[model samples]
Target: MPRRVSLPSADDLFRPTSPDGSDRSPGEAAERPAEQAVDQPADQPVHGARPAPRRPSGRVRHDEKMTVYVTSEELHDLEQARLTLRRTGLTVDRGRLVRAAIALALAGYEQDGEDSALVQRLRDA
Candidate 1:
């Protein structure tokens, strides 16, 4: 059996370490200018006006898990494809490439379903 390893949490990865083993909160790390601070008066608009809207956070919305199985050779092919795409000036990782291919395939399948309607209309004409 393969030995299992536990992954560290994001907090553990970014947590500050002191020589004496003390922890520092994230807010204590550094301060910005008053104009740059989120809570500062200058950072807010006058007359209670709202700032420009921001994009919805691209973070995962659910605590869901998935398991996928791939052979070593398949994984190597994926890595090679990722490298090739990077060399061509299109920055893409294996996961992104896979997701894009899946999306394309789904779109093609939907279009295939509509092909019969077009074929029947052509035959009627």
Candidate 2:
């Protein structure tokens, strides 16, 4: 008789990782349609008014990859910030934090152009 291998069922394989039922793979969010993932009113105008605040894609899908090199001191600072936020019960990863920071900088730049903090910092650097 051949030895039969028992494989886990699809349900078991795809079961949520968290007990509270909020577990989701990071890439899963990328699969969602923007209309479904983001809550926008049907009546809301798509443009003209000041754009909505640029919110970081927290726990959502990030399909693109970006590589940034940071100095040791900068890395330490990032870890420190992550730890500090963890202490406050935010529990965010470095990537998510970096995304949020990028969103903030981009928003600032969009609103301020050459007068933005990002441009000023780059100039100083």
Candidate 3:
């Protein structure tokens, strides 16, 4: 058997420290500004009419991963598109290009319903 050691309580371990050594805890730290931010909708106007619709921020957080299998010609077309965008000074990976295309297809489907280009392309195949 090993010797037992004493440790601080959970409260002491999680307590937030201040420069002046005050007794503020992590819970208290979280309650300050977050409450106000959470109380309001993100897209709501602070003071006035409704704001314009938000566009895609284009920042990939990569919270999820996906695997796609493409033919050699499809892969070549994707690489060509990536190179074309690079020539236009928009540096992005092929995955980003594919993601943008998916977003466009989804938006077009939503806007056009059965008459969407996405549906037509799928039906053609």
TM-score against truth, every candidate: 0.40, 0.66, 0.57
Candidate 1's residue-wise lDDT over 47-101, tens digit each?
7575333222122222334567989998999899989989999887665677665
**Error of model 1, residue 115, in angstroms:** 8.8
Tens-digit per-residue lDDT, 1-125, candidate 2: 99999999999887765556655566677777788678675434477887666777677544589999999999999999999999999999999999999989988987899999999999999
How well is each residue in 2-118 modelled by candidate 3, as lDDT tens digits? 999999999887554544443444455565676543566544557766543433425433446789999999999999999999999999988778878887786677667799999
* Regions of model 1 farther than 4 Å from truth: 1-65, 114-125
- Pairs that collide, model 3: none
Q: Model 3 TM-score?
A: 0.57
Model 1 residue pairs with clashes: none
By TM-score, the better pick of 1 and 3 is 3
- Give the residue spans of candidate 2 off by over 4 A: 1-47
On lDDT, the candidate that comes out on top is 2
Backbone clashes in candidate 2 total 0
Top-down TM-score ranking: 2, 3, 1
- Where does candidate 2 have its weakest 10-residue lDDT segment? 16-25
lDDT score, residue 102, model 3?
Answer: 82
